[model samples]
Target: MVTKIRKSQRIHARIVVMDSDKEAVHQLMRLLGKEGYKVEAIEQINKMLEKIKNEQIDVLILAVEAWDNRGYELIPTIKKMNRFLPIIVTSADDSIETATRVREQGIFFYAIKPLDIKEIKLALKNALSKKFVSSGEALFIQKEEIQKAFDDEILDLADASKILKLSKPTVSKLVRNGELPASRIGNKWYLIRNQLLEWLRVTAAGNQRNYGTLILETMDEGVAVVDRRLKIVSCNSAYLQALDVPRDQIIGEYCYRVSHRSVVPCDESSCPVRQAFRTKRPVKFMHINYDSEGNEHYCDVIALPMKEKDGKVAHVVEIIRDNTETYNLNRHLNWIRSFFAHECRKTLGPIVMNISALVDENLSASISIERRDKMLLSSLCSLKFLHDMIRNYIISCKYETEKLQCNKKSVYVYKNIFPQIIEEFHPILSKKGMDIETEIKGERPIWCDPDFIKIAFSNLINNAVKYGTAKTKIVCWLKMTDDEFEFNILNEGVGIPHDKLYDIFNRFTRFGKLAISGTGLGLHVVKLIVEMHNGTLKAQSGYLIDNKPITYDEFYANENLYKMKDKNLRKFARFILKIPSGEDTQKMEV
Candidate 1:
């Protein structure tokens, strides 16, 4: 509801609202109608001039999108037609140029959207009342206010005392103390109704109460407004946390001293605030700061300049937004780049050298069958490494761009995803003389993205082969529940340490003392694929450990989970995946 006040002019006022957005028009109409004002909504700005010319518009409410430049150009034309008509402008763009233009037009109020409804109502009320006061038309005021204005433009101290129902001596005292809006003309004090109302409002609300401190305190971004001297005039809670300082200790201190911990101002080339002041616009930069606990923090800082009278730079407002997550993500990406570059060189160099040897040996003398077979195997390994690198890189890029779409359907385990994985890993298992068991708990067909699920399963099986010991028993099983499908792969070997179970899913992770043939993104890509399907992957291993619940490998041989007398512990690692089913699984497929 609008803040109600006694109107000196009782007749209803007319308001015209112009906005291309249909919802904005309906909303403004509803709000204005509730306040007893007749609202005329206009959508087309080009036709607004003709429509408004005929209407007795007391206030014109205009909101313009940045792309609608023509709508903004019409502000002065409307004002020229009705000089006393108060125009309140609202813009989607909160840039300095928009604010400066509004100020230049002497707009009664200008707000940036998405604006609070209460703020818009207040701005409208202020614009209307300002017009009423300046024009003396009393379009939105009480009848008595008009009569009083006609009687005298400036009421004396005695008149003001009577109007306010206060003693003349008290009014004189308030005037003398600068508490009232009255000023002495030669020997007597006089006041205007506009000035008196403004003074009373300020006195009741307190001048500082209307400031943006409340908004700043509630914002998540760190905000600080500083003077030209770099002294902090106002700082929000986020800013206090950013600087790791108490409010009492920081309010009066220099900003450079607090933020940079320096005695002098910031470096000219690196200071966004100084740059903003110099450019008379907003300037942005990224920097690293540290918290009280000594952890480095990455932040993106934006500085906006405030201009004083005569268009001179006055103050600067700085906003800090944390980008630590993005910074770390980028670092991980760089690591991947380095690791991939090494893999490419390591894979390609061997193949090139082997090809050269084949040509030389074949041309110079008859090449032995043994040497030919060895060179062919080397090329195969090189091609496999290159293929895996390209595939993983493409998948990672797709995930990063949010373009990794999953086309899901009903997939038969025995017919679709399972047989291919078994066939692919059969060679590795055969070489190690390992045993593989396939077990099904329920129905065979499950709903999922068959292709990606195949990728995820193949990666897990390959991981087991690469890290698990030779001559081990590998178990692959599918267990169906009432609402979900579960897939499990377990192999007996030197398993992951309990402490590193979760960490193994991170990109570029390598475990154990053995050299593995991978760039370490296989498991990370598997994790991303599983998460995309709204599923979970858990890694578990059983090895020698004490009775501690976690069962880490750090325990001495004297512990219980290993063996009774022997310190040597056999290791087994398992990967479990749970994906929801029954309902429309297509929706679950990202």
Candidate 2:
């Protein structure tokens, strides 16, 4: 028989929220609980499906993404088990492909990122209106897969045998052995379907069911239920224990006082509780909370809205998970990054310049020499490499700290940073039997820090000289758009391996087996400095043919679709950087 719910009072069923996202699971659990439902939220996909198979479920909310197909693959299983069960798919990936894939599974709805309360409610209401399959109809859909509320409604021995797939004697034997729930009525065996479901779940769990206070006390995440007045109505053991406060002291206190020790609200900028109240939906945020001793810790907070029938928010369920260990590790990493950055600038810059000058003087000698000249040139190269490595370390540090401050001054890229870098690296390229070709379109003044700009350009050019094939021409091209300045350094080298291209900008990530000596921080530093100037950068690998490759004009023509127009060419590497002119920097407050 089909069961339908027309009101919250009639929703005497369980909602299974199966999602891998922790915040999504909590939010959906709160929403379902608000509608007077017994919500069972499980994070692991396998465990969730196991519950779905064992327990009686009315609605299944799949709110998982950022993982893989393990969550989505369960869609077909839900359909095959019970054709009447509703699956509501939610994901942050709102692409057309994603929507089409969800539609193929015949889901009730596809909710995009940042779900709306109204949309969820409307979908649930629609889901409840549909009637379930009759027992005769459901029996055709694999009896082993049918575990629902109706399975325990009521059935005589004749229909009960169909659900159990056992003969009357065997069924009676089980009932006689107390393995099943049944009673004799007028010389015939009869049983409640709900009892059969309870037996199955208990037998599968190998213990008593967990619910109500038992479930609340065992949760690892701190949960607090607060009313509209910001007073805590109730809290679980985890909350009291996490705060190290007694239940009597916490029950009637204001949430703000206990969590932040303040009379006012938490950070007004992006508090999850405030956002949830304002939007009338679930909201998540990371907050820094302190203990009684003033030690700070990071908490991932999710505020779930629980609304009354009249559409008023009666209470909010807040889940707070501690992430202090992750926060401290990040703080230490930042300190290391900053220390290396400062060391490089203060000590190594002069050493490289001194060695270069001495090497030049010796190479310009009037008399014949071989061993002494080779020794001086090699030492100069080594010092240059050390200087570059240190400089890159510092740049990467600035980027992570978000301390790469912009000291904007009007300057021409072609005249100031560009020519100076070309002159500095020209000798190295010449020594490699290579030459740099430049194409600078009508230069314009840009607002930027000249020193960082020079450093970024020098890194790109020096990378070409160090890594490019000897005797191949290097291309340095610049173009000015209305809002941003674009630059590209094209080198004909063996090219970054296709497998390693994605990680070249990552700090300390060296590409696959290139003989080049580097700190592996050069590209990462360039990326950060460009971002500081409100710019962007990318590396595309392709090949040049017959001493000719895409020119500045050709790249501009297909700038919209320039990456891989063809696959038959030799592999070459191109680093592109774009800096916005006079763009504002968005700095978030601590």
Candidate 3:
């Protein structure tokens, strides 16, 4: 019953063949033997189970004619014994009914009896390709103990405790207390390692199964597990819904087949699955997966290898976290900061020249006093506004990367960050003839980057001024929740049409009152800083039902419903910049 495959060390496999026809069975043996395959054939139903347990097998080829309904009966038991084993069933009947019945039973293959050598070889090759098992056999096996019990009862408390290094008394106590299963052997108790190990495996598998189930059941993260061959094995409901995958069509398909919409695997540069397999390590990247309907989603992906007992990789587990909002915002912020920085640099020289000319003209009396003073004042105001804008842009960029450069101090958020932004923007607000105020409903610093928060709020206030009417008041409200701090800036002007609320945050979307010249990146930058602190940003424009809009709905109908109102305002673009926190920002600079 012991058959060990050799010669083709590259092809490591064990095969078991059982046939009732003596002459046909010998023919199979001759063919397999000539091909240098180690194969065992058994005719008796009783002997099949024993041979399967004793010998290692990559495949089991059973002749359905061997024992009439007996072959059908053995299939379930064999599967239970080892679910990974591939079973190929053959029948001499060649009837469609028999083939159909065996197919329903989940046999790996169904072939007519007196099987063609070609068919058998093909089935065997296909089965062997997917076979995987633990390695490193131990020499100190307890044969006597293994022989005394059935497959399920083979591993007993005595053997398991011995292998696990627990005292027999403790093992016995565990068994007696129903913590472990034990069988009575006359007047003594016995533990078989096979049974005990299998039990341990089942329990361990159960724990992992439940853990995955819980995550998929409740977690917002979408997850999927793909095998080493790049085949998708399982996915959670969230993954299916997020990917918009047709469950029946995807279950047996390869990962790339579904995700990339490719006929073959993606090329080396784009294949995260291949990298994970090649390096035997986890790989993470950001990707946008689109379904058949062409709906795109932003996903943060992590692929981890699942190793076998020998430490060889068996599969890869992929966890995808959606980050569309964060990514778009960061992208928009970078563009905004870069563009504004360029503009400020360009305007500085001109403003300085204008001021010098005005001073010289006044001193020389070459220009009228009124004209000189007006020129000087306008130039100064332009210089001041541009300088402030540049500073805010720089600070916003720093905060986005968690590298805000300033003295760090502990102070209540309302007392420090909020006041700084309000004070800095007060002159600009006055110049614009806009009234702005801050109301703090919280009293703690809440452990945050103050300079970052200040600049972020400054951008918000500036946006409100630039977009609102000249005589309107901008209300800045700060509220601290159980685990987060929220800030809201409200302005009265031509409100952002509901559709454009989400669109305005997009890098190129500058839609508001006509007078405000903007890069359409200010709100995008604000969103980036807010998210960098693990907070969220949202906007609503409309009067409150109670003349005080506390919730988004109270201000206007849910903006999201009006898809065409302003498509890009409220839904800001996102960018992902991997940077250290304020505490670790020094590492990047140094």
TM-score, per-candidate, Cα-based: 0.47, 0.43, 0.38
- Model 2 superposed RMSD (Cα): 20.5
Candidate 3, 352-451: lDDT as tens digits: 7767776674554787777765666556656655765556556555665678544544446677566666666665665667786667774534545666
Winner by lDDT between candidate 3 and candidate 1: 1
Clashes of 3: 34
**TM-score of the candidate numbered 3?**
0.38
lDDT of 1 by residue, 43-74 (tens): 65434554544445667878765225445666
Q: lDDT scores for all predictions? A: 0.70, 0.69, 0.63
Worst ten-residue run, lDDT, model 2?
Answer: 132-141
Q: Tell me the deviation in Å of residue 501 in model 2.
A: 3.5
Candidate 2 Cα misplacement greater than 4 A, ranges: 1-370, 550-569, 583-590
Per-residue lDDT, model 3, residue 15, is 73
Off by over 4 Å in 3: 1-342, 363-381, 384-408, 413-420, 440-446, 478-486, 503-509, 512-515, 543-590
